[model samples]
Target: MPKTISFNDNWTFTKTDSPAYSRQTIVQGQPVTLPHTWNDSDGQGGAEAYYRGACWYQKVLTINAEDLSKRIYLEIGAAGNMGEVYINGQLAAESRCGYAMFRAALTPHLKQGDNLLAIKVDNSYNNEVYPLGADFTFYGGLYREVKLLVMDDIHFDVMDNSRDGVYLTQASSGEGVFRLDVRGRLVNEAAASANGRVLVQLKDHEGAVVWEDSQELAVADAAEFELSGSICNPVLWDGIEQPYLYTAEIRAIVQEQIVDTRQIEIGFRTVELTADQGVILNGKPIKINGVCRHQDFGGIGNAITKAHMELDMELIREVGANSIRLAHYQHDDYFYSLCDRYGLLVWAEIPYISFPSTLDPDSRNAFEQLELLIKQAYNHSSIYCWGVQNEITIAVETENTYRIIKELVAEARRLDPSRFVAQANINGVADDSIINTFTDLVGYNLYYGWYYGEIKDLGERLDDFHRTRPDKPVLVSEYGVDTNPNYHSYTPQVQDYTEEYQLLFHHNALETFKARPYVLGGYVWNMFDFGSANRKEGGEVGKNLKGLVTIDRSLKKDAFYLCKAYWSKSPFVHLAGRRFVNRHEQLNDLVVISNLQHIRVYLNGELLTEIKDGQPLNVIKAVRLILGDNHISVEGIDEQGERYTDEIMLRHVLESDSSYIYVKEEKTEHVVNWFERFDLSAPGQIEVKEGYYSIYDTIEQLYRNEAAKAVFLKYFAHVTDNPFFEVTQGVMSIEKMSQLVFYGIPPELLPVINRELNRIAK
Candidate 1:
């Protein structure tokens, strides 16, 4: 077995722009612990953008002389954007993409004792690195666990970045029979290659060896070998029903003695998406009840702990999510492992988000990141699809852009043919767009009622897309509205930041999905509100309130229940708008969301209405509001007579009560050019409007072609004054007046935006 130790304590950190290093810098550095970040405070607010530069971490690793004979390797769980590792002042390894795990061999660089291990982690805004511009904050630091693994000479290859020397992919052949394909890469440091023999075994839940296979191959320095076998009776890993897992032990033997061993968890299942059949799992059609998730939590800025990850997974499961779209980028390996153990189907991808101004470095980084993501996550059975890009149309698509996209999809298939390749497009991108045709299954991030059209428009647009792309499978990868728990609205409308509007938005979106079977899945934009750093809308600064739950996971919004009503099978009733206790409207709608058919609503002690066998959306009963506090109770009964009920106390206020009465009426000018905030001066308004027209003219002239300018205008036009959308769109309206006014935008973003604008300007 492999021996490992946590190397996470007693580290020194400092911010440095220079690449040069000195021992004095380390001695005077601030002391800190692992799971720490430099952007903890600065990255959470919109007061000023966080620092976009490099930082250094230094730690001393002491190794005994006797342990020097073992093969030693240093493993970093994660680093942000870019990281480089050094031992005893000598370069050991450097990793470009920071999300995945990387292992560097340290046997050659270590001394007898007291080896100095220095790591330089950079989250600086680099135009070459991916996510140069995305919605989420790119936190800087070595924010995850670091470890040292010691093993014998004959060991499995941990340097592949995937960290697994062994891989397992399983499929059901027939009744009670399964095919388990295994791939193992081995390294023999011993003088003679003839002494190496690899052993692979699969063990059941009871720890009994059910299948065993051994092979002897010609091994020089390193060799990759494959084994094909069959299991007579396999316990299938079905979603939520039976998340069964089998343990696999692969041992490398030299001269009949076990030298190194690796253990991996394996799940047997198959996933397929058909244009007409939707998602098929293990030969059964299953609708994907899914949600998109961001890595950061309330206090943790991407420095998530195991407990944090566990809680997030628990919450996702509680909300009845059968699948997860690991949005924008690859997550921690441990979280992917949890998905394997929990049987949540996953859509894993790289940070190839938004649009790229130039295809050179951004697409180059995308290719490298995709390689690392697939290599590290290849063995996970939970990943059914590999998402290639997200909303790249935010930037103008060019011939070079098309070339990069086609390359990514082809490379993903070449690397792992077992998983389907997918990508998410921005709204307004036509179904016949060339980019949509690159992926096996196409996904679009659409917000109909909230962004531009009515709720009913969701179904119509989906139907239109399906009719056009009848041979291709499609999914609504993201759809949501920002909702603040503190905000309440009687006449809710788009962008009201009210809980009522959130519920209605989801109710309509879910209804659209229910109407079309061709749309395989729909994932909510977010499961938990996340830190956007530069966001100022939604009644909260530096946060995206589109999540079903709060950033702290403290409160579940009313929309969460609306989703549960349709997605969950657990019979339960929840009173919507419990947080909005003070109501202004006399004709109040008392709504109850439940999976159960029969629900009875009671006002005070008297029965108001018996909603027998109501629709899955909601059970609604209108009531006249009293002047003071009123008690309301609702009970739902399942077929088995098991009852789930909820009650709440609501206070009715007169229309004259200014604090309780809330109404929203949208202005056409403000709605069309939504980027301008209410704080703009009369002169500033004229300047902004002029800048907007100038920006559009520049885009048209620079793109030259109608197609490119059309795509560019879709993202930049009507952008909110907040640069959050600007970063995502990658288009800077370089009207000088506009840039000077929007000073809150990080200084680093200006260079990127201006460079693209200047390209067109010239």
Candidate 2:
């Protein structure tokens, strides 16, 4: 039998890249454990100051004399961006795909005593990598587990993309019969040829054998074999209702002596995607109530543990979400296992996101990463869609971009024909773009209410897409707004960063998704706030606040309960606006969210109103309150006569609280009427003098001139410190500054900026 040992302790790590340091050199660094990162602190701090470079980690592995004769291998669960492994000062193996697992044989490099092992991991900006640019922070380190596998001379191949070497394909052949195809590879390192029998068994969840088969294997160095079987009336692995699973155990026996064995948990199910209907799982239609998740935690960067993953799954389950979209890249294998047990449909994607590199090597890297992602996660039954790209055309769309995406879609289908391929197009991508039609399913990251248009326009925009492509299955892959719990408002509006506006946005969005069944379903932008080093919005730096739960997992925003009311089956009532305690108006609207149909409201110990057949969101308008503090409570009873209650206290005030508002630092008094004096219609009025910079010039052109750069940065830096300016500098024209009024840039400042730039000669 094979022995797997954890190799995660007593490693020395340093953020600096010591080129001279090797196995013979002593490393001067702090001792650390596996699943660690250098960006835990700096990555969460604002201002794009996080460290993104090469780091060094070294560990000493002592091999016993008795174990030196066996086949020894070292496995790295994951290394960010890229990594290289060295044994005894010699390069052994390298992995270009940052988020995939890989292993290297250590038998040739190991001795009978201590052996020096070192790894160099880099997360720096590389055009050849898949995620050249994205919104989330890329933390650098050996952020996953490491293991040592000791096996006999003849064993299952562990070098096939770091897989289990056993591939099982399950399908429904007919009305009560299912077929299974098993493919496996083995490696024989003995001095002479070996003959063995490979036994394969299918066992139910109760550990009872349902089917078995054996195959003869004879090999010198490497060999491959296949086996086929069938089962009668196998239980189907349904959605959240009942997720049944079976186990496949494979063993290698030499002369009736078991040498090596591998076990894998498997599930049998069918998924169908249609143009009019949503996801059909196990011959039933199901809406995908999903939330997108980033594998990071507050103050932890990307060095999360199994406990952290479990907590995230608990929160997702609490919100009554039936699915999850593991955004941007491949996640931990343990997380996939959790999804399998919990029965959450998943949207697994690669990190070919945001901007596409024109380099051909980058395209090849994308293909290789997709292959590793599919092969490693092929056994998980929770994954229904393989997302190829997300917002890939946001920077610039070209012929190469279209070709790369088409090839990725084709490769994903070719690798695993059992699942469908999907892509998340940017909101601006036209309905007629060929990129949208490249994948089997299509999704759009629409933010109508939060970014550009009114909240009500979401439904209209979705309708337009459905009308244009009635034959395509469509979904909203991402939708959300940044919200801060410290801010509150009675008149909620877009970009306010208030808890009330966030609630209103999701309320309207949920209603919109429910009204249209042709539109598959939507996944919330994020389940928790995550680190974005370039962001300085919502009165916070280095974070995107578009999450139902806070990053620390301490507080659940009011929008969370609103979702729970609609999706969760638990009979409960929640009084909304508990965080917004102070109000200036004497008469205010009291809101309550509950799953129960009947709800009773009380104000200051008096009966305020009783609502029958109440919806998920109940609003009692124009309820009079006392001059000082008033108590509000809501109650609901389930069918079992168990009462659930929620209460809060609100204080009525005559004046507004300035602390509750987010005030921009720039003064707006002097620029109140500056827009009236400027003209935009007449092109001849604002002349672009020869050898001078003007609004007609691109931002890149202005930044090239020392005098023009200073003038442009003085005003624009007050609104956002996002590095997106650098991304769009060469492409976006300075005239687009007028459209930044939505982002808190004053409309009047555009002419002033152009005027100052025009004064400086080119």
Candidate 3:
């Protein structure tokens, strides 16, 4: 049996000025733990930004005398961007990809006693490693677990970025029997020929060996072996219903002695995405209720533990989601294992995102990184598809771009012929684009309601795409609106940080998805808010507030219950606006989300109303609130007589109190054909004055600034006469225009905007 030890403790760390190797550098570092990032303080959000450069980590390995005969290797679960490892002043290995796992053989450098293990990690922006310019922050460090593997002279090949050098591919042949093909490589380090037998066993959760096979091989320094067999009456690894896993044990035998052994926990299942039937798992059709997730937590960037990953999965599963889209990059290996165990279907993709960089270096790095991802995560049954690229069409595609993408898809299929290939295209990709015709599965990251177009356009856009590519499976990969719990509007509009808008947006999107059979599924933009240092929009600075749950994972936005009511089988009722407590409106709509059939609501101990004709996910009714505090209660009963109840207290303040009062109605202008006209101008130059954005910046910041609005309105009034006001409104952000109106736009400024637009037209 092979043994492994934790190499996470007793490490010293220090920031370095350069990526060069030196013995004195390790001596000058400070003590730290295995999972440490230099960006813990400044990476999240600040004007200065975090340092993205080289860092050093060193540790002493005191080997036991008896263990020296064993082959030793250092396995890094993950390192940021690039890493160079050295043992006793000698370079062992170098890895460039930040998200994938890598390993180095330390057996040759290991002495009988103490050995020096040093690593230089550089997360500096590079042209080779992916995500050259992404939205989320990339924190640098040796941010994941490190392990030391000790094995016999003859062992399984663990040198490459593989799932321990052993891979099992299974397909449901017929009559519930699965044909399992197991293959693995063996290394005879002594360079001696030893006639060896590779023994493979399939054990159940009860530890009973259900199938066994052996392949005899004439072993050289390195050799390969494979075994084929059928498992009779095997328990299927069903999604969420029953995530049964089987253990595959591979052992190498020499002269009746077990030289080396490795065991892998695996699930046996078949996944298919069809145009007519949607996602089929194990011969049964199922809908994918999913969400996209980033790997960072609130304060602790990506240097998280298995416990943190488990907690995230648990939260996802509790939301009634049976699937997850691990967005933009390969996630932690342990998270994939949890997905297998918990029965969540996953769409695993690489960060070959945004667009192609330098074809020679960047494309090469992308292909290698993607290969590493597939190899290391091949055996996990949770992954049903491998994503090639995400939103790559956002930039202009060149001939090299098409060539590189084609190569990526080909490489992914060549490496793992069993999985489906998919890509998330930007919304701008037309129906006739060649990019859409390449993948087995394709999803569009379209924010129709929030970004530019009306909410009603989503259904038609998806229908048009399906009509164009009737053969390919389509998914609405990402769609959602941002919301700050503090902002609430009775009449919500786009870009308004209101919980109501998010709720309505999801309601509309889900209805559209439910109506379309050809659409496979949709993954909501985010499961939780994440840190983005440069972001300052939607009442949040340095954060993407589109998550169903807040950043801290403590508060679930109102939209969370809406999804739960739609996806979860568990019967429950939740009152919305639990966070938005103080209200100034005299009449408010009390919303209730439940998985039950009907809901009875009470306000201030009085039976307010009982709603039977409600949407599948939401129940809303207008309620009149008295002065001071009002207590609200709800009770719901499913058809099976399962009763669920919840309560919340809300305060009603008079509008005359005059401190952040609520508005029932506001003057709003819906800008039609805004982007169509805006795209005509190449972002026309407007001088940026000190401490301000361009002239158009009024759309983002001046909404609530009285003094600033006065300055801009006066400035616009002087530009031109009746500055084609209708054209100006149509050529800018409708949400921003609506904000300008709601907060107070001067009537004279409309003509000024019109005149300016007319001058630009001339």
Candidate 4:
């Protein structure tokens, strides 16, 4: 049985005082666990402001040094930016890279007696080492898995450590001749040269012999080795569709005794990736319908759980997407494993975000991380591409970084030929010809009307990209913005600035894709609102609300289901609400549409019409101009030819006139509070609310006018200038909510007041 150990326990700690290392103070704060980090608490500004310098952590562990008599090694999952290990005050090993795993042998240091382990966690910024350009806070301390393993005299020796993580290389198909290359580094911290014979033992289930080997290596010098073998009765591993895993154990032995051991799951399947074909698995064309994800959620920050990741994947799968891009940096191992089991395609990347202009060092880091990513994740075949960077060229707005990225792309392809190499850019505008020379595929993070205004201009942007670089495959990597669902009131008129407008925006986007052959795929700007301490919605209080789902993952706006409808082929007939047949009579009846492909609209099981072209966008029909709870079904088509359908309840209202207007008054109490108290949050919410409300046909105009007016209210209150939406906001001329202070109204009714502004401005 595989031995299980825990790195979570009691430890003594002290803070280093001076560079001389003479003054040190011991303090008790809290307990820590392996596979952990001081990510959240440190650098919190107030009480937990992050401190620099040396902090030591010590722990007493019970070891079977006598009975086991085998080689005992101390394994550290990860440390902060950098760390040094000391067993019984004797320096054991030193390491860097806050993200990878490292281990050190402790048997030689053991004097057949009780020992103490101390680790110095150094998180000070170092411009020379990796993870330097990363934007987020570099929390100090040990923040990964830690363990102590006692193995047989001659166990399996470790071979490689990749950024993707430590794992055996995986190939497609198990029946063919397979080579198992076990790689690792053996560090000998000794005065004299220590010679040890490394014996590689390959064992299978039922204790069957598959392959084995041995090599003479000197421990004083860290040496590398690769073991090869073939399995006759091979077991293949695949994803959910054909789930199967074969286990292989490779052990390093010395003098007929095991010393180190490692296990791997073998999966047989080739990932055929190329520019023209995209990603192909098992000889079939596959599209990576994925999302660029951030390793964060509402409250959890980066310490998200498997449950959290699963929920996001579940949502992605529910929307018929089968791939994901682990944007900007490497994530926890659990996420990649989840992809393997769930059959979601992955594009893992490094943390070379937009930074300083000079990037020669980035090249070296990229090369190192590339090796780490490929070597560690070589076993799992879910990864499709290695995303280089997102809009760094513009974020830094430099030429040198562009050249560095260009060379790195070529290097990535040379390192990992099987997987595709991608770069998330800010649209192929500036470095047009240069981009195609480097990347296998180009992903453009585009925000047409939202950021630059003129949503209609997206076509021209796409046209220019195709005209400039026609050979490269294109993708709309990121789009969408913060949207809120609670606010109500909308009209389905063109340019009306309501939920209808948001619907039109996406509808236009979807239509745009249908016309463009250069576009392969597109993912929204974000999946959900995440936490960024510095971002107050830009002078506002809430976090990133751009997700189709809310920050807490609780609320999913109508935009979520609406976008789902565009991509969903399933049958869906929704009765939004009743329309105005007559105003005074107050008829609670409306029209319903099918959100799926040709689903014959049936009223009481009578065929109303055959929904053909508008299957996705238009799925409903007029039914007594309806209201209240109603039974509906999205007809599901299975092999049996039995159709299925989905139903929903909506309270539709009737409109009396083509043009309607209303104005409400507020008291002086509401005015003083406006200046006396400023909620930067209110301004930020205006855009998100508009983005969500823009689901209606005329939502943008409403947003351009009402939401813009509200934001201006707050900005004009203090700054007198707001760069929030320079281009987009200019489309509408409006003042800030301070007008409310002058008019004397309730601050709570800002939504209503904003809506009235939408009516008056139009």
Q: For this target, which candidate reaches the highest TM-score against the unseen true structure? A: 2
By lDDT, the better pick of 1 and 2 is: 2
User: What lDDT, from 0 to 1, does candidate 4 have?
Assistant: 0.54
The residue ranges of model 1 lying beyond 4 angstroms of the native Cα positions read 16-27, 46-49, 174-176, 190-194, 357-362, 619-621, 655-762
For each of the candidates, give the backbone clash count.
4, 0, 11, 94
lDDT of 2 by residue, 131-193 (tens): 877788888889989999999998988888847877888888888788888888888989898
Ranking by TM-score: 2, 1, 3, 4
- Candidate 1 lDDT, tens digit per residue, 1-762? 568998889998888644554233474688888887777756666455677677889888788977888888989887887888888777898877878778788899988878888888988766677777777778888878889898877688887666777777787788778898888788877677655678889999999998989888677889887887999877888877788988988888877888788788888887788988899988898888899999888777888899999999988888888899998888988899999889899999988887564436347788888988998888888899999889775655566667878999999999888889999987757778888789998998888888667888888888888888898999899999988887777677887788889888999888888778898979998899987876667667678889999988999998888888888888888888787787776678877888888988888878888877657655454688788888999889988998889999888876534443334445467454443442223222212232222343334343565544654444444544544543433343333223332223333333334433334322
Q: Which stretches of candidate 3 lie over 4 Å from their true place?
A: 18-21, 25-28, 46-48, 359-362, 656-762
Kindly provide the TM-score of model 1 when superposed on the true structure, using C-alpha atoms. Answer: 0.88
Worst 10 residues of 1 by lDDT: 683-692
Q: How many pairs in model 4 have backbone atoms within 3 A of each other, for residues 3 or more apart or on separate chains, i.e. clashes?
A: 94
Cα-based lDDT for every prediction: 0.78, 0.84, 0.78, 0.54
On residues 1-762, what C-alpha lDDT tens digit does candidate 4 reach at each position?
124466656765556533222112234534554434454544322235446556677776555546346566676655666778777666777765555556666766666545677788786655444554432445566655567765543333432454212245544335465556555554443355556655555555456656667667765545555555555545443433553445556554444555555565545556654445555666565545456576666544454556887898777665555667776666667777777767766778766554422224345655566566666566665776787766554323345666778777777777666667888776534536465567777878777766555678777787777777666777777766544343223344322223334455556666676567557656665666554432333222325445666666786555555666655455444443222122222232233344544455444344555555654465342344244333333343434465756554443344434322121233356344454464334432232243333212222344456654454454234333332222112122232222212233344444443443444433
Q: lDDT of candidate 1?
A: 0.78
- Hey, what RMSD does candidate 3 come out at? 8.7
Model 3 C-alpha lDDT per residue in residues 1-762, reported as the tens digit of each score: 678888999998888654344344464768988677776546666556667888888888888878787888899977887898988888899888889889899988888787888898888867557866566777788888999988888888998579679888988888878999999899888857788899999999999999999999878888898899999879989999999999998889988899888778888888888998799998888888889999888778788888889889988987899999998888999999999999999999999887455434337888988989999999898999999998764544556667778889899999999999999987877877888778899899888878768899999998898788888889989999887877776677888768888999999888888887788879998999887665666666678889999877888998988998889888888998876677788788888888777888888888888867645565455677788899999988778777789999988886533222233343223223222322233334333334443334422244345554454454433222322232232123222343232223333334334333333211
